[model samples]
Target: MIGLGELVNSEGEFGVDDYRACLAAKHANLERAIQEEWERPAPDQISLTALKRRRLKVKDEIVRLRTGKAIGRRLAAPA
Candidate 1:
């Protein structure tokens, strides 16, 4: 639930290169995790558990980014 106003300042401050690097890192990490998990074959229950953990990891990162951007925007805004 990040507000656009809060992220405006962050967007202005972060260069394209910085954003690209961040995206690259995130994608690499996610791909690594999925590949590691898919390598192991398991029962249905275990499969579900693994998927849930993966989903949580992704969700956590998303939340962190959203909050960070919101805070950054507020700080960047004028008084």
Candidate 2:
């Protein structure tokens, strides 16, 4: 299964800048969706929760990529 973290360019290569840009666009769309949902008189909890979860996942991937770390890898911070 392809994951967002495994995104590739049209040339079939992973470009950090391109990936970041894509993530940014996705994040923006998610934010807009969340805002729209909130604007509704009767917001749906399920939809809001799903959107927020997806947004958070995208954010985490952006952070991980920016830090030059592979997705799903955890490194202990110095105490």
Candidate 3:
């Protein structure tokens, strides 16, 4: 897990934008991994699910950092 504090510096050398870009690279890598797994002759469902979850986490982190807010889930209306 990438900790926000680890990436940041006391001198402010790493700004939010830089951190976001780093996360962007990670996001792209995860996307490629997911696609590659999907393209296999027999994709591993477990592996795919894990990769997807990790990718989503990275995406959510990126959004939170960019917007200064956590992404909220929209609950379905009562039937």
lDDT of each: 0.52, 0.78, 0.75
Residue-pair clashes, model 1: 1
What's the residue-level lDDT of 44 in candidate 2? Answer: 99
Which residue segments of model 2 deviate by more than 4 Å? 1-10, 71-79
lDDT by residue (12-52, candidate 3, tens digit) is 35566657777888889899999999999999999999999
Q: What is the number of backbone collisions in each predicted candidate, taken in the order shown?
A: 1, 0, 0
Worst 10 contiguous positions by lDDT, candidate 3: 70-79
**Candidate number of the best TM-score:** 2
Residue-level lDDT for 26 in candidate 3: 87
lDDT of 3 at 47: 95
Estimate, for each residue in 1-79, the C-alpha lDDT of model 1 and write its tens digit.
3333433444555433344345445656656666676676853667556765765675565565656653443232323
**Which order, best to worst by lDDT?**
2, 3, 1
Ranking by TM-score: 2, 3, 1
C-alpha lDDT of residue 2 in model 3: 53
Give the per-residue lDDT digits (tens) of candidate 2, residues 11-77. 4566566567777889999999999999999999999999999999999989989887865544322
C-alpha TM-scores of all predictions: 0.39, 0.73, 0.70
